[model samples]
Target: MSGILSEDALDTLFRHARTHNAWQDKPVSDETLYKLYDLMKWGPTSANCSAARIVFVKSKEAKEKLKPALSAGNLEKTMAAPVTAIIGYDVEFYERLPELFPHAPEAKTWFNWSKEWAEQTAFRNGSLQGGYFILAARALGLDCGPMSGFDMKKVDEAFFAGTTVKVNFLCNLGYGNPDGLFGRSPRLPFADVCQIV
Candidate 1:
Protein backbone atom coordinates (compact mmCIF):
# COMPACT_ATOMS: atom_id res chain seq x y z
CA MET A 1 0.00 0.00 0.00
CA SER A 2 3.03 2.28 0.26
CA GLY A 3 4.86 1.66 -3.01
CA ILE A 4 4.63 3.32 -6.39
CA LEU A 5 1.17 2.92 -7.86
CA SER A 6 0.20 0.91 -10.94
CA GLU A 7 0.47 2.55 -14.36
CA ASP A 8 -3.29 2.79 -14.66
CA ALA A 9 -3.56 4.51 -11.32
CA LEU A 10 -0.80 6.92 -12.25
CA ASP A 11 -2.47 7.55 -15.58
CA THR A 12 -5.74 8.27 -13.89
CA LEU A 13 -4.10 10.91 -11.73
CA PHE A 14 -1.57 12.40 -14.10
CA ARG A 15 -0.35 11.17 -17.52
CA HIS A 16 -3.77 10.94 -19.21
CA ALA A 17 -5.59 13.36 -16.99
CA ARG A 18 -6.41 16.71 -18.59
CA THR A 19 -7.70 20.18 -17.88
CA HIS A 20 -11.11 20.06 -19.46
CA ASN A 21 -12.90 23.04 -20.99
CA ALA A 22 -16.10 21.36 -22.07
CA TRP A 23 -18.39 19.14 -20.03
CA GLN A 24 -21.31 16.75 -20.44
CA ASP A 25 -24.70 17.71 -19.12
CA LYS A 26 -24.42 16.06 -15.77
CA PRO A 27 -24.71 17.16 -12.14
CA VAL A 28 -22.28 16.64 -9.27
CA SER A 29 -24.22 15.76 -6.18
CA ASP A 30 -23.64 17.19 -2.72
CA GLU A 31 -22.52 13.78 -1.50
CA THR A 32 -19.74 13.71 -4.08
CA LEU A 33 -18.58 17.17 -3.04
CA TYR A 34 -18.49 16.10 0.59
CA LYS A 35 -16.51 13.00 -0.30
CA LEU A 36 -14.09 15.01 -2.42
CA TYR A 37 -13.37 17.31 0.53
CA ASP A 38 -12.91 14.38 2.90
CA LEU A 39 -10.35 12.85 0.58
CA MET A 40 -8.45 16.01 -0.32
CA LYS A 41 -8.31 17.32 3.23
CA TRP A 42 -5.72 14.69 4.03
CA GLY A 43 -3.19 16.38 1.75
CA PRO A 44 -0.45 17.94 3.88
CA THR A 45 -0.22 21.61 4.72
CA SER A 46 2.40 23.47 6.70
CA ALA A 47 1.51 22.94 10.39
CA ASN A 48 -1.79 21.61 9.06
CA CYS A 49 -3.03 25.19 8.66
CA SER A 50 -5.50 23.80 6.09
CA ALA A 51 -6.44 27.18 4.67
CA ALA A 52 -8.39 26.36 1.52
CA ARG A 53 -12.01 27.48 1.45
CA ILE A 54 -14.17 26.45 -1.50
CA VAL A 55 -17.57 27.51 -2.78
CA PHE A 56 -19.25 25.25 -5.32
CA VAL A 57 -21.30 27.29 -7.77
CA LYS A 58 -23.87 24.87 -9.19
CA SER A 59 -27.25 26.54 -9.33
CA LYS A 60 -28.31 28.83 -12.12
CA GLU A 61 -28.51 31.70 -9.67
CA ALA A 62 -25.07 30.99 -8.29
CA LYS A 63 -23.58 30.70 -11.78
CA GLU A 64 -25.10 34.04 -12.67
CA LYS A 65 -23.52 35.57 -9.62
CA LEU A 66 -20.17 34.36 -10.87
CA LYS A 67 -20.72 35.49 -14.46
CA PRO A 68 -19.54 39.05 -14.25
CA ALA A 69 -16.31 38.01 -12.59
CA LEU A 70 -15.20 35.60 -15.30
CA SER A 71 -13.01 36.63 -18.19
CA ALA A 72 -14.75 36.75 -21.56
CA GLY A 73 -12.92 33.65 -22.84
CA ASN A 74 -13.75 31.64 -19.73
CA LEU A 75 -17.39 32.61 -19.61
CA GLU A 76 -18.84 29.99 -21.94
CA LYS A 77 -17.15 26.87 -20.62
CA THR A 78 -17.59 27.85 -16.98
CA MET A 79 -21.24 28.65 -17.46
CA ALA A 80 -21.81 25.31 -19.16
CA ALA A 81 -20.07 23.44 -16.38
CA PRO A 82 -22.09 21.45 -13.86
CA VAL A 83 -20.18 23.00 -10.98
CA THR A 84 -17.65 25.81 -10.80
CA ALA A 85 -15.67 25.77 -7.57
CA ILE A 86 -14.32 29.04 -6.26
CA ILE A 87 -11.18 28.14 -4.36
CA GLY A 88 -10.12 30.69 -1.78
CA TYR A 89 -7.73 31.21 1.12
CA ASP A 90 -8.78 32.53 4.45
CA VAL A 91 -6.39 35.23 5.62
CA GLU A 92 -7.52 34.52 9.16
CA PHE A 93 -6.81 30.80 8.88
CA TYR A 94 -4.36 30.89 11.77
CA GLU A 95 -7.23 31.71 14.10
CA ARG A 96 -8.13 28.04 14.01
CA LEU A 97 -4.57 26.84 14.65
CA PRO A 98 -5.09 26.51 18.39
CA GLU A 99 -7.74 23.90 17.58
CA LEU A 100 -6.20 22.47 14.40
CA PHE A 101 -2.60 22.27 15.62
CA PRO A 102 -3.36 21.69 19.27
CA HIS A 103 -0.28 19.60 20.04
CA ALA A 104 1.48 22.99 19.97
CA PRO A 105 -1.06 25.60 20.95
CA GLU A 106 1.49 28.32 20.27
CA ALA A 107 1.04 27.60 16.55
CA LYS A 108 -1.91 30.02 16.42
CA THR A 109 0.32 32.98 17.16
CA TRP A 110 3.04 32.06 14.66
CA PHE A 111 1.38 33.75 11.68
CA ASN A 112 -0.09 36.61 13.63
CA TRP A 113 3.25 38.39 13.51
CA SER A 114 2.38 40.14 10.24
CA LYS A 115 -0.30 40.37 7.58
CA GLU A 116 2.20 39.47 4.83
CA TRP A 117 3.43 36.32 6.59
CA ALA A 118 -0.04 34.96 7.29
CA GLU A 119 -1.17 35.71 3.74
CA GLN A 120 1.87 34.01 2.28
CA THR A 121 1.24 30.86 4.28
CA ALA A 122 -2.44 30.86 3.44
CA PHE A 123 -1.87 31.25 -0.30
CA ARG A 124 0.84 28.61 -0.44
CA ASN A 125 -0.97 26.00 1.63
CA GLY A 126 -4.36 26.74 0.09
CA SER A 127 -2.89 26.30 -3.38
CA LEU A 128 -1.52 22.92 -2.39
CA GLN A 129 -4.98 21.90 -1.27
CA GLY A 130 -6.35 23.06 -4.62
CA GLY A 131 -3.93 20.77 -6.43
CA TYR A 132 -5.05 17.94 -4.17
CA PHE A 133 -8.64 18.73 -5.11
CA ILE A 134 -7.98 18.22 -8.83
CA LEU A 135 -6.26 14.88 -8.31
CA ALA A 136 -8.89 13.74 -5.85
CA ALA A 137 -11.63 14.58 -8.33
CA ARG A 138 -9.88 12.72 -11.15
CA ALA A 139 -9.37 9.67 -8.92
CA LEU A 140 -13.07 9.63 -8.14
CA GLY A 141 -14.13 9.41 -11.81
CA LEU A 142 -14.65 13.13 -12.30
CA ASP A 143 -12.98 15.41 -14.82
CA CYS A 144 -11.43 18.78 -13.94
CA GLY A 145 -11.18 22.24 -15.48
CA PRO A 146 -8.95 24.28 -13.19
CA MET A 147 -8.52 27.89 -14.28
CA SER A 148 -7.36 31.33 -13.16
CA GLY A 149 -9.02 33.37 -15.86
CA PHE A 150 -11.25 35.42 -13.66
CA ASP A 151 -11.30 38.69 -11.82
CA MET A 152 -10.14 37.76 -8.35
CA LYS A 153 -11.37 40.94 -6.70
CA LYS A 154 -14.81 40.63 -8.24
CA VAL A 155 -15.07 36.97 -7.34
CA ASP A 156 -14.13 37.78 -3.77
CA GLU A 157 -16.86 40.40 -3.64
CA ALA A 158 -19.44 38.13 -5.22
CA PHE A 159 -18.71 35.02 -3.18
CA PHE A 160 -16.79 36.02 -0.09
CA ALA A 161 -17.99 39.48 0.94
CA GLY A 162 -17.77 40.24 4.66
CA THR A 163 -15.17 37.48 5.04
CA THR A 164 -11.39 37.33 5.19
CA VAL A 165 -11.29 34.85 2.29
CA LYS A 166 -9.96 35.74 -1.13
CA VAL A 167 -10.32 33.81 -4.37
CA ASN A 168 -7.21 31.97 -5.49
CA PHE A 169 -8.47 30.08 -8.54
CA LEU A 170 -11.57 28.50 -10.00
CA CYS A 171 -12.29 24.93 -11.12
CA ASN A 172 -15.12 23.47 -13.10
CA LEU A 173 -16.06 19.89 -12.27
CA GLY A 174 -18.13 17.27 -14.04
CA TYR A 175 -17.77 14.71 -16.84
CA GLY A 176 -15.58 16.17 -19.56
CA ASN A 177 -16.61 16.00 -23.22
CA PRO A 178 -14.01 14.31 -25.41
CA ASP A 179 -15.31 16.22 -28.40
CA GLY A 180 -13.98 19.38 -26.84
CA LEU A 181 -10.54 18.18 -25.76
CA PHE A 182 -7.50 19.76 -27.34
CA GLY A 183 -4.31 18.05 -28.46
CA ARG A 184 -1.78 17.34 -25.75
CA SER A 185 1.08 19.79 -25.52
CA PRO A 186 4.70 18.91 -24.89
CA ARG A 187 6.30 19.09 -21.46
CA LEU A 188 9.82 19.98 -20.41
CA PRO A 189 12.32 17.13 -20.52
CA PHE A 190 13.76 15.96 -17.20
CA ALA A 191 17.10 17.60 -17.89
CA ASP A 192 15.44 20.87 -18.79
CA VAL A 193 13.35 21.09 -15.62
CA CYS A 194 15.13 18.97 -13.00
CA GLN A 195 18.66 18.10 -11.88
CA ILE A 196 20.34 15.57 -9.61
CA VAL A 197 22.56 16.93 -6.92
Candidate 2:
Protein backbone atom coordinates (compact mmCIF):
# COMPACT_ATOMS: atom_id res chain seq x y z
CA MET A 1 0.00 0.00 0.00
CA SER A 2 2.92 2.30 0.65
CA GLY A 3 4.27 1.81 -2.86
CA ILE A 4 2.96 4.24 -5.43
CA LEU A 5 4.22 5.79 -8.64
CA SER A 6 5.37 9.38 -8.65
CA GLU A 7 3.32 11.88 -10.67
CA ASP A 8 5.90 11.90 -13.43
CA ALA A 9 5.93 8.12 -13.51
CA LEU A 10 2.15 8.02 -13.78
CA ASP A 11 2.18 10.57 -16.59
CA THR A 12 4.86 8.69 -18.47
CA LEU A 13 2.91 5.44 -18.17
CA PHE A 14 -0.15 6.98 -19.84
CA ARG A 15 1.41 9.60 -22.16
CA HIS A 16 4.35 7.63 -23.52
CA ALA A 17 2.48 4.40 -23.98
CA ARG A 18 1.67 3.93 -27.64
CA THR A 19 0.61 1.21 -30.04
CA HIS A 20 4.10 0.29 -31.09
CA ASN A 21 4.54 -1.28 -34.51
CA ALA A 22 8.33 -1.52 -34.63
CA TRP A 23 10.73 -2.89 -32.06
CA GLN A 24 14.41 -3.01 -31.39
CA ASP A 25 16.13 -6.41 -31.66
CA LYS A 26 16.76 -6.51 -27.93
CA PRO A 27 15.28 -9.46 -26.06
CA VAL A 28 12.65 -9.25 -23.35
CA SER A 29 14.13 -11.01 -20.34
CA ASP A 30 12.14 -13.72 -18.56
CA GLU A 31 12.57 -11.73 -15.36
CA THR A 32 10.83 -8.74 -16.88
CA LEU A 33 8.02 -10.89 -18.20
CA TYR A 34 7.48 -12.37 -14.77
CA LYS A 35 7.43 -8.94 -13.21
CA LEU A 36 4.95 -7.74 -15.78
CA TYR A 37 2.64 -10.62 -14.85
CA ASP A 38 3.08 -9.89 -11.18
CA LEU A 39 2.00 -6.29 -11.64
CA MET A 40 -0.98 -7.12 -13.82
CA LYS A 41 -2.27 -9.97 -11.65
CA TRP A 42 -3.26 -7.44 -9.02
CA GLY A 43 -5.82 -5.77 -11.22
CA PRO A 44 -9.41 -6.62 -10.25
CA THR A 45 -11.53 -9.20 -12.05
CA SER A 46 -15.16 -10.24 -11.69
CA ALA A 47 -15.38 -12.77 -8.89
CA ASN A 48 -11.60 -12.77 -9.29
CA CYS A 49 -12.18 -15.44 -11.94
CA SER A 50 -8.86 -14.36 -13.50
CA ALA A 51 -9.60 -16.08 -16.78
CA ALA A 52 -6.77 -14.72 -18.93
CA ARG A 53 -4.14 -17.13 -20.25
CA ILE A 54 -0.97 -15.82 -21.91
CA VAL A 55 1.31 -17.68 -24.30
CA PHE A 56 4.57 -15.94 -25.04
CA VAL A 57 5.95 -16.63 -28.51
CA LYS A 58 9.69 -16.17 -28.64
CA SER A 59 11.13 -19.33 -30.13
CA LYS A 60 11.67 -19.42 -33.86
CA GLU A 61 9.49 -22.53 -34.21
CA ALA A 62 6.64 -20.89 -32.32
CA LYS A 63 6.89 -17.73 -34.40
CA GLU A 64 6.96 -19.81 -37.56
CA LYS A 65 3.76 -21.52 -36.52
CA LEU A 66 2.12 -18.12 -36.10
CA LYS A 67 3.42 -16.56 -39.34
CA PRO A 68 0.99 -18.14 -41.78
CA ALA A 69 -1.85 -17.15 -39.48
CA LEU A 70 -1.13 -13.43 -39.57
CA SER A 71 -2.28 -10.99 -42.20
CA ALA A 72 0.37 -10.38 -44.84
CA GLY A 73 0.85 -6.77 -43.76
CA ASN A 74 1.20 -7.76 -40.09
CA LEU A 75 3.56 -10.70 -40.61
CA GLU A 76 6.71 -8.60 -40.59
CA LYS A 77 5.93 -6.71 -37.40
CA THR A 78 4.64 -9.79 -35.64
CA MET A 79 7.76 -11.71 -36.56
CA ALA A 80 10.06 -8.88 -35.65
CA ALA A 81 8.89 -8.28 -32.12
CA PRO A 82 10.85 -10.04 -29.37
CA VAL A 83 7.73 -11.49 -27.83
CA THR A 84 4.21 -11.99 -29.13
CA ALA A 85 1.64 -12.94 -26.54
CA ILE A 86 -1.32 -15.09 -27.50
CA ILE A 87 -3.86 -13.84 -25.03
CA GLY A 88 -6.49 -16.46 -24.28
CA TYR A 89 -9.47 -17.13 -22.04
CA ASP A 90 -10.14 -20.33 -20.14
CA VAL A 91 -13.68 -21.62 -20.49
CA GLU A 92 -13.50 -23.22 -17.04
CA PHE A 93 -12.28 -20.19 -15.18
CA TYR A 94 -15.01 -20.45 -12.57
CA GLU A 95 -13.62 -23.69 -11.16
CA ARG A 96 -11.32 -21.50 -9.17
CA LEU A 97 -14.08 -19.19 -8.04
CA PRO A 98 -14.25 -21.12 -4.80
CA GLU A 99 -10.90 -19.64 -3.87
CA LEU A 100 -11.45 -16.33 -5.60
CA PHE A 101 -14.94 -15.71 -4.33
CA PRO A 102 -14.68 -17.60 -1.09
CA HIS A 103 -17.65 -15.89 0.46
CA ALA A 104 -20.06 -16.77 -2.32
CA PRO A 105 -21.00 -20.33 -3.17
CA GLU A 106 -23.34 -19.48 -6.04
CA ALA A 107 -20.71 -17.52 -7.96
CA LYS A 108 -19.12 -20.69 -9.33
CA THR A 109 -22.42 -21.63 -10.96
CA TRP A 110 -22.33 -18.43 -13.00
CA PHE A 111 -19.37 -19.54 -15.10
CA ASN A 112 -19.71 -23.29 -15.00
CA TRP A 113 -19.36 -25.77 -17.87
CA SER A 114 -22.38 -24.29 -19.63
CA LYS A 115 -20.93 -23.03 -22.92
CA GLU A 116 -22.99 -19.86 -23.23
CA TRP A 117 -22.38 -18.55 -19.74
CA ALA A 118 -18.76 -19.72 -19.71
CA GLU A 119 -18.02 -18.08 -23.03
CA GLN A 120 -19.49 -14.78 -21.90
CA THR A 121 -17.63 -14.65 -18.59
CA ALA A 122 -14.35 -15.82 -20.03
CA PHE A 123 -14.34 -13.29 -22.84
CA ARG A 124 -15.49 -10.41 -20.68
CA ASN A 125 -13.11 -10.97 -17.77
CA GLY A 126 -10.24 -12.15 -19.94
CA SER A 127 -10.45 -9.00 -22.07
CA LEU A 128 -10.39 -6.91 -18.91
CA GLN A 129 -7.17 -8.66 -17.87
CA GLY A 130 -5.73 -7.93 -21.32
CA GLY A 131 -6.10 -4.21 -20.67
CA TYR A 132 -4.38 -4.72 -17.34
CA PHE A 133 -1.55 -6.45 -19.18
CA ILE A 134 -1.01 -3.41 -21.41
CA LEU A 135 -0.96 -1.03 -18.47
CA ALA A 136 1.48 -3.23 -16.56
CA ALA A 137 3.76 -3.57 -19.58
CA ARG A 138 3.85 0.19 -20.07
CA ALA A 139 4.53 0.74 -16.40
CA LEU A 140 7.46 -1.64 -16.65
CA GLY A 141 8.94 0.35 -19.57
CA LEU A 142 8.00 -2.06 -22.33
CA ASP A 143 6.30 -1.17 -25.60
CA CYS A 144 3.09 -2.87 -26.77
CA GLY A 145 1.73 -3.70 -30.22
CA PRO A 146 -1.84 -4.97 -30.09
CA MET A 147 -3.58 -6.35 -33.15
CA SER A 148 -6.73 -8.21 -34.14
CA GLY A 149 -5.68 -8.98 -37.69
CA PHE A 150 -4.75 -12.59 -37.21
CA ASP A 151 -6.50 -15.86 -37.94
CA MET A 152 -8.18 -17.03 -34.78
CA LYS A 153 -8.60 -20.63 -35.84
CA LYS A 154 -4.94 -20.99 -36.73
CA VAL A 155 -3.92 -19.42 -33.47
CA ASP A 156 -6.14 -21.71 -31.44
CA GLU A 157 -4.92 -24.76 -33.32
CA ALA A 158 -1.32 -23.82 -32.76
CA PHE A 159 -1.55 -22.88 -29.09
CA PHE A 160 -4.60 -24.42 -27.49
CA ALA A 161 -4.97 -27.79 -29.21
CA GLY A 162 -6.29 -29.77 -26.22
CA THR A 163 -7.34 -26.94 -23.96
CA THR A 164 -10.43 -24.87 -23.36
CA VAL A 165 -8.50 -21.60 -23.68
CA LYS A 166 -9.82 -19.56 -26.56
CA VAL A 167 -7.72 -16.90 -28.24
CA ASN A 168 -8.67 -13.38 -27.27
CA PHE A 169 -6.08 -11.23 -29.05
CA LEU A 170 -2.41 -10.91 -29.93
CA CYS A 171 0.08 -8.51 -28.43
CA ASN A 172 3.65 -8.01 -29.59
CA LEU A 173 5.91 -6.55 -26.94
CA GLY A 174 9.47 -5.32 -26.47
CA TYR A 175 11.40 -2.08 -26.69
CA GLY A 176 9.92 0.02 -29.47
CA ASN A 177 11.84 1.79 -32.20
CA PRO A 178 10.41 5.27 -31.88
CA ASP A 179 12.00 6.36 -35.13
CA GLY A 180 9.86 3.86 -37.00
CA LEU A 181 6.53 5.07 -35.63
CA PHE A 182 4.10 6.93 -37.85
CA GLY A 183 2.71 10.16 -36.47
CA ARG A 184 0.72 9.76 -33.26
CA SER A 185 -2.90 9.14 -34.08
CA PRO A 186 -5.66 11.34 -32.72
CA ARG A 187 -8.14 10.02 -30.15
CA LEU A 188 -11.82 10.73 -29.75
CA PRO A 189 -12.45 13.90 -27.80
CA PHE A 190 -13.75 13.55 -24.23
CA ALA A 191 -16.77 15.74 -25.07
CA ASP A 192 -17.92 13.33 -27.74
CA VAL A 193 -16.89 10.15 -25.95
CA CYS A 194 -18.33 10.32 -22.46
CA GLN A 195 -21.59 10.97 -20.58
CA ILE A 196 -21.73 12.70 -17.16
CA VAL A 197 -24.79 10.76 -16.00
Candidate 3:
Protein backbone atom coordinates (compact mmCIF):
# COMPACT_ATOMS: atom_id res chain seq x y z
CA MET A 1 0.00 0.00 0.00
CA SER A 2 3.00 2.30 0.48
CA GLY A 3 5.34 1.47 -2.39
CA ILE A 4 5.34 2.57 -6.04
CA LEU A 5 4.23 0.07 -8.67
CA SER A 6 6.71 -1.08 -11.33
CA GLU A 7 6.58 0.43 -14.83
CA ASP A 8 4.78 -2.62 -16.26
CA ALA A 9 2.09 -2.36 -13.62
CA LEU A 10 1.67 1.35 -14.38
CA ASP A 11 1.40 0.58 -18.09
CA THR A 12 -1.18 -2.10 -17.47
CA LEU A 13 -3.33 0.28 -15.43
CA PHE A 14 -2.96 3.37 -17.57
CA ARG A 15 -0.47 3.88 -20.40
CA HIS A 16 -1.14 0.73 -22.42
CA ALA A 17 -4.87 0.68 -21.78
CA ARG A 18 -7.02 1.53 -24.78
CA THR A 19 -10.65 2.18 -25.42
CA HIS A 20 -11.27 -0.91 -27.50
CA ASN A 21 -13.90 -1.08 -30.18
CA ALA A 22 -13.37 -4.73 -31.13
CA TRP A 23 -13.01 -7.74 -28.88
CA GLN A 24 -11.96 -11.39 -28.90
CA ASP A 25 -14.52 -14.15 -28.45
CA LYS A 26 -13.86 -14.34 -24.75
CA PRO A 27 -16.31 -14.46 -21.87
CA VAL A 28 -15.83 -12.71 -18.57
CA SER A 29 -16.81 -15.09 -15.79
CA ASP A 30 -19.35 -14.19 -13.12
CA GLU A 31 -16.69 -14.98 -10.54
CA THR A 32 -14.44 -12.44 -12.22
CA LEU A 33 -17.19 -9.80 -12.09
CA TYR A 34 -17.57 -10.47 -8.38
CA LYS A 35 -13.83 -10.12 -7.88
CA LEU A 36 -13.89 -6.84 -9.84
CA TYR A 37 -16.49 -5.28 -7.58
CA ASP A 38 -14.80 -6.58 -4.45
CA LEU A 39 -11.63 -4.82 -5.48
CA MET A 40 -13.24 -1.54 -6.58
CA LYS A 41 -15.49 -1.12 -3.54
CA TRP A 42 -12.55 0.02 -1.45
CA GLY A 43 -11.99 3.25 -3.41
CA PRO A 44 -12.73 6.12 -1.04
CA THR A 45 -15.89 8.15 -1.52
CA SER A 46 -17.06 11.16 0.41
CA ALA A 47 -18.67 10.06 3.71
CA ASN A 48 -18.33 6.57 2.25
CA CYS A 49 -21.54 7.41 0.40
CA SER A 50 -20.73 4.54 -1.98
CA ALA A 51 -23.39 5.66 -4.43
CA ALA A 52 -22.34 3.85 -7.59
CA ARG A 53 -24.35 0.82 -8.71
CA ILE A 54 -23.54 -1.34 -11.72
CA VAL A 55 -25.66 -3.56 -13.93
CA PHE A 56 -23.67 -5.96 -16.10
CA VAL A 57 -25.56 -6.70 -19.32
CA LYS A 58 -24.24 -10.04 -20.60
CA SER A 59 -27.02 -12.33 -21.74
CA LYS A 60 -28.82 -11.93 -25.06
CA GLU A 61 -32.00 -10.77 -23.35
CA ALA A 62 -30.21 -8.08 -21.35
CA LYS A 63 -28.28 -6.89 -24.40
CA GLU A 64 -31.51 -6.58 -26.34
CA LYS A 65 -33.01 -4.59 -23.53
CA LEU A 66 -30.07 -2.19 -23.64
CA LYS A 67 -29.88 -1.98 -27.42
CA PRO A 68 -32.29 0.81 -28.17
CA ALA A 69 -30.51 3.10 -25.75
CA LEU A 70 -27.15 2.97 -27.49
CA SER A 71 -25.99 5.59 -29.97
CA ALA A 72 -25.19 4.54 -33.53
CA GLY A 73 -21.43 4.44 -32.99
CA ASN A 74 -21.72 2.44 -29.77
CA LEU A 75 -24.41 -0.02 -30.86
CA GLU A 76 -22.34 -2.59 -32.76
CA LYS A 77 -19.43 -2.69 -30.34
CA THR A 78 -21.60 -2.74 -27.24
CA MET A 79 -23.73 -5.58 -28.58
CA ALA A 80 -20.57 -7.55 -29.42
CA ALA A 81 -18.66 -7.05 -26.17
CA PRO A 82 -18.53 -9.71 -23.50
CA VAL A 83 -20.08 -7.30 -20.99
CA THR A 84 -21.55 -3.82 -20.87
CA ALA A 85 -21.63 -2.29 -17.43
CA ILE A 86 -24.24 0.33 -16.61
CA ILE A 87 -22.71 2.49 -13.95
CA GLY A 88 -25.24 4.58 -12.04
CA TYR A 89 -25.54 7.02 -9.17
CA ASP A 90 -28.00 6.60 -6.36
CA VAL A 91 -29.52 9.95 -5.39
CA GLU A 92 -30.81 8.51 -2.17
CA PHE A 93 -27.42 7.08 -1.23
CA TYR A 94 -27.52 8.86 2.11
CA GLU A 95 -30.07 6.33 3.32
CA ARG A 96 -27.29 3.77 3.60
CA LEU A 97 -24.82 6.02 5.41
CA PRO A 98 -25.53 4.46 8.76
CA GLU A 99 -23.83 1.28 7.64
CA LEU A 100 -21.39 2.51 5.01
CA PHE A 101 -20.26 5.44 7.14
CA PRO A 102 -20.92 3.78 10.51
CA HIS A 103 -19.78 5.80 13.57
CA ALA A 104 -21.66 8.80 12.17
CA PRO A 105 -25.30 7.91 11.97
CA GLU A 106 -26.00 11.62 11.79
CA ALA A 107 -24.33 11.76 8.38
CA LYS A 108 -27.53 10.46 6.86
CA THR A 109 -29.40 13.56 7.99
CA TRP A 110 -27.00 15.81 6.09
CA PHE A 111 -28.94 15.07 2.94
CA ASN A 112 -31.86 16.99 4.42
CA TRP A 113 -29.89 20.17 3.82
CA SER A 114 -30.73 20.18 0.11
CA LYS A 115 -31.93 17.75 -2.48
CA GLU A 116 -29.81 19.41 -5.17
CA TRP A 117 -26.60 19.12 -3.14
CA ALA A 118 -27.29 15.49 -2.35
CA GLU A 119 -27.73 14.72 -6.03
CA GLN A 120 -24.51 16.54 -6.87
CA THR A 121 -22.60 14.62 -4.20
CA ALA A 122 -23.99 11.32 -5.44
CA PHE A 123 -23.03 12.04 -9.06
CA ARG A 124 -19.56 13.25 -8.13
CA ASN A 125 -18.67 10.34 -5.87
CA GLY A 126 -20.29 7.82 -8.18
CA SER A 127 -18.16 9.15 -11.05
CA LEU A 128 -15.08 8.52 -8.89
CA GLN A 129 -16.18 4.95 -8.30
CA GLY A 130 -16.68 4.49 -12.03
CA GLY A 131 -13.03 5.52 -12.60
CA TYR A 132 -12.02 2.90 -10.05
CA PHE A 133 -14.04 0.32 -11.99
CA ILE A 134 -12.03 0.87 -15.19
CA LEU A 135 -8.68 0.66 -13.41
CA ALA A 136 -9.78 -2.46 -11.57
CA ALA A 137 -10.79 -4.13 -14.82
CA ARG A 138 -7.50 -3.20 -16.52
CA ALA A 139 -5.58 -4.57 -13.53
CA LEU A 140 -7.42 -7.84 -14.05
CA GLY A 141 -6.25 -8.09 -17.69
CA LEU A 142 -9.55 -6.91 -19.18
CA ASP A 143 -9.98 -4.24 -21.82
CA CYS A 144 -12.48 -1.41 -21.34
CA GLY A 145 -14.39 0.72 -23.83
CA PRO A 146 -16.07 3.36 -21.70
CA MET A 147 -18.44 5.63 -23.55
CA SER A 148 -20.98 8.40 -22.99
CA GLY A 149 -22.63 8.06 -26.39
CA PHE A 150 -26.01 6.78 -25.25
CA ASP A 151 -29.49 8.02 -24.54
CA MET A 152 -29.40 8.54 -20.81
CA LYS A 153 -33.16 8.62 -20.35
CA LYS A 154 -33.55 5.44 -22.35
CA VAL A 155 -30.89 3.67 -20.34
CA ASP A 156 -32.42 4.75 -17.05
CA GLU A 157 -35.84 3.66 -18.18
CA ALA A 158 -34.54 0.30 -19.38
CA PHE A 159 -32.39 -0.56 -16.37
CA PHE A 160 -33.25 1.67 -13.43
CA ALA A 161 -36.99 2.34 -13.68
CA GLY A 162 -38.69 2.41 -10.26
CA THR A 163 -35.27 2.53 -8.63
CA THR A 164 -33.35 5.35 -6.89
CA VAL A 165 -30.49 5.00 -9.35
CA LYS A 166 -29.81 6.74 -12.67
CA VAL A 167 -27.40 5.78 -15.42
CA ASN A 168 -24.11 7.70 -15.57
CA PHE A 169 -22.16 5.96 -18.34
CA LEU A 170 -21.52 2.65 -20.08
CA CYS A 171 -18.39 0.56 -20.52
CA ASN A 172 -17.95 -2.45 -22.77
CA LEU A 173 -15.55 -5.01 -21.35
CA GLY A 174 -13.63 -7.93 -22.87
CA TYR A 175 -10.33 -9.09 -24.29
CA GLY A 176 -9.55 -6.45 -26.90
CA ASN A 177 -8.80 -7.20 -30.55
CA PRO A 178 -5.65 -5.16 -31.14
CA ASP A 179 -6.37 -5.11 -34.84
CA GLY A 180 -9.12 -2.58 -34.07
CA LEU A 181 -6.89 -0.10 -32.28
CA PHE A 182 -6.00 3.19 -33.97
CA GLY A 183 -3.08 5.50 -33.28
CA ARG A 184 -2.86 6.68 -29.69
CA SER A 185 -4.03 10.24 -29.18
CA PRO A 186 -1.86 12.90 -27.59
CA ARG A 187 -2.48 14.07 -24.02
CA LEU A 188 -1.87 17.50 -22.54
CA PRO A 189 1.39 17.68 -20.61
CA PHE A 190 1.33 18.43 -16.87
CA ALA A 191 2.92 21.85 -17.43
CA ASP A 192 -0.09 22.96 -19.45
CA VAL A 193 -2.69 21.62 -17.02
CA CYS A 194 -1.17 21.99 -13.57
CA GLN A 195 -0.39 24.78 -11.08
CA ILE A 196 2.19 25.31 -8.33
CA VAL A 197 2.27 27.77 -5.46
What lDDT would each prediction earn against the true structure? 0.95, 0.91, 0.95
The superposed Cα distance between candidate 3 and the true structure at residue 15, in angstroms, equals 0.9
**Residue 58 displacement in candidate 1 (angstroms):** 0.5
Per-model TM-score versus the true fold:
0.98, 0.94, 0.98
**In lDDT terms, how accurate is model 3?**
0.95
Candidate 1 backbone clash number: 0
Residue 27 of model 2: what lDDT? 99
- Across 113-189, the per-residue lDDT of candidate 2 in tens digits comes to 58898889889999999999999998888999989999999999989999989999999999999986888788889
Q: Candidate 3 clashing pairs?
A: none
Model 3: runs farther than 4 Å from truth? Answer: none
Q: List ranges where model 2 is wrong by over 4 Å.
A: 1-5
Off by over 4 Å in 1: none
lDDT of 1 at 85: 92
Report the C-alpha lDDT of model 1 over 1-197, residue by residue, as the tens digit.
Answer: 48998999999999999989999998999999999999999999999999999999999999999999999989999999999999999999999998889999799789988999999999999999999999989988999999988998899999999999999999999999988899998999999999899
Query: Which tens-of-lDDT digit does each residue in 79-115 have in candidate 3?
Result: 9999999999999999899888888979998885888
Candidate achieving higher TM-score, 2 or 3:
3
